[model samples]
Target: MRQPQQERSRTTRRRLVDAAVECLAERGWNGTTVAVIAERAGVSRGAAQHHFPTREDLVAAAVEYLGEEQISELRARAAALPDGPSRAEPVAEMLLDLYTGPMFRAALHLWVAASTDENLRAVLVPLEARVGREAHRVAVELLGADEARPGVRETVQATLDLARGLGLANLLTDDTRRRRQITRQWARILEPAVATRTVRESA
Candidate 1:
């Protein structure tokens, strides 16, 4: 009885979090009300309230849940890439895919909302920091970037920043062509740095 109850609780919470993400993506912060999220989740208002006592609490939990899901998906995608000298482009492409998708859009909505809402900022800042750190770790590991080498860490960070900027552009304009051009160009630059580090370490 206890086990089943716990499982059901988890299911309900998951549905609520997922519904919150969808709400955030479809409607901006002001539009994503607790009642709306409950409707989308197919749960009663009381149940939503029981799960999340306040709007801030619910949105914070939703962001954390989405961040975890994104990180897990990132790791899985990274693990699927073929290991070789030619892995950099595919890794970079995978990173771009992660940055340009629905989860990123949901996060962008939160970022814009948090700019004016102190409560939201208080919840988002630390969560964003954690997600950024984990993303950097995954990128460096999957791309076999040698941070011990001079400027390698900075290069990897810059690549991520560049990708994010491109993704932001994608939100407003059709930057797909430019994004591809820039990604390929950066991949060319990054591959050499990775190769130099490998040779130096092997020598």
Candidate 2:
């Protein structure tokens, strides 16, 4: 039996997306090109171009693909969170882990590149906004945050901002111990702020 042409094309596209992310993470934007991604994907440059005519097209597709994957994983992790007072620490850790992964590194490269390139920024800005909104929504759910309460929403957003900052710090060096310590402290501070009782009782 042989695979259908549609399935084959899908596989090729998946490979190209994966390879593009890997290239971005490993080589940054300058070193990542259509030809490099094509070679890494094990497809001809012509085939790669056939699927994504421009580098921006491929990068946009990859960001969109990675964003969905991150959101799906976030939902799964949120479901598995333990039911107890200790949940905040794990929730903090989970959200921080989101930014420390390969996808974030790949996205960071694009962010720096997009800072200077108007065309790339045009392609990336909307995609990044969508991803950021989804991330914030999931963080709210995971934290059991009651946005109806004052400051609760900002607290959740701060956690995400902290995670992103830590992720950027990790790009230059391994600061795992310090990062973990900071998240633990933030979790302590965060738990009381977002806890259901605190939200209801706070005046």
TM-score of every model? 0.90, 0.91
| Number of the predicted model whose TM-score against the real structure is largest | 2
Overall lDDT per candidate, in order of appearance? 0.81, 0.88
User: For candidate 1, lDDT tens digit of each residue in 94-194?
Assistant: 77656676667778898999999998899889988987898888878877888888988998888788778877888866777877777787778888776
Question: lDDT tens digits, residues 44-155, model 2?
Answer: 9999999999999998899889888888988897798665456788888888877887889999999999999999999999998988899999988787777888999899
- Find the 10 residues in a row with the least total lDDT in model 1: 194-203
Q: In candidate 2, which residue pairs clash?
A: none
True-structure Cα RMSD, model 2: 3.1
The top-ranked prediction according to lDDT is 2
Error of 2 at 58 (Å): 0.8
lDDT measured at residue 158 in model 1 versus the true structure, 0 to 100: 84
Alpha-carbon runs more than 4 Å astray in model 1: 195-203
